[model samples]
Target: MKRLIPLFALCIGLPAAAQTPQLILESLVAKAGPASAARGEQLYRAKSKAGKTADSCAACHTDNPKAVGQHVKTFKAIDPLAPVAQKDRFTDPAKVEKWFKRNCQEVLDRPCTPQEKADFTAYMISVK
Candidate 1:
């Protein structure tokens, strides 16, 4: 009974298991699914606070993937959804969290829900 008591106490004190990154990604992808690209497009075009309306994504970027942006300073023009470059970015969890937090507030007036983030990411991956 001594071992049983300790085991019970340990179980009670332990926190629930955290979700794996792959599982989280899978869940997010499920929300985004086949519609992810469309959702991404919507997010891209989401209005900023200035009330100018329209996504900043297309503002600096031209039709060509290589087209550059003037507003971002010297950074290369980013095609976030393009499949060719999809693997280059957004894979980092820290970067993902930062961008979503910043971008969602810029457009949606608040941080995105987990579902929204998941769906957005799903869409992002699909664009490539």
Candidate 2:
């Protein structure tokens, strides 16, 4: 019970963006299993099997997610993925879905599953 205090406090201290991630993660977990930050990190960094020239999310997003990213094809600047770096990230459900749909299609050649979305979001929010 004593150990739970700090955990609760940490949860309460999280910003509103964290809540959106939690809500998204929760909904995804209902379809998938539990979300995993480790899996999320793996998914973020993993090279795609889809054979795209920009094989991994990291190829565009950079290995350090807190840093700004640029598109491989478009070369357009992008905001950071980590909530700590860009507080607005994952806050808008429509924006989140839109990016996931576009990005997952690019990386995986298919839409991401709930598990992948949850894991990826978990990983992003976990970044300091």
Name every residue pair that clashes in candidate 1: 82-128, 83-128
lDDT for each residue of candidate 1 in 13-121, tens digit (9 for 90 to 100): 5312332333335544544443355665665555565423324545544333233334354455455434345444544455566777775665556777776676555
- Which candidate should be chosen as best, given lDDT against the real structure? 2
Off by over 4 Å in 1: 1-24, 27-35, 48-83
Count of backbone clashes, every candidate in sequence: 2, 0
Candidate 1 at 27: error in angstroms? 5.6
Worst 10 residues of 2 by lDDT: 13-22
Q: What local distance difference test score does each model get?
A: 0.50, 0.79
Candidate 2 residue runs with Cα over 4 Å from true position: 1-19, 51-53
TM-score of each: 0.51, 0.80
Give the backbone clash total of model 1: 2
Q: How much does candidate 2 score in TM-score?
A: 0.80
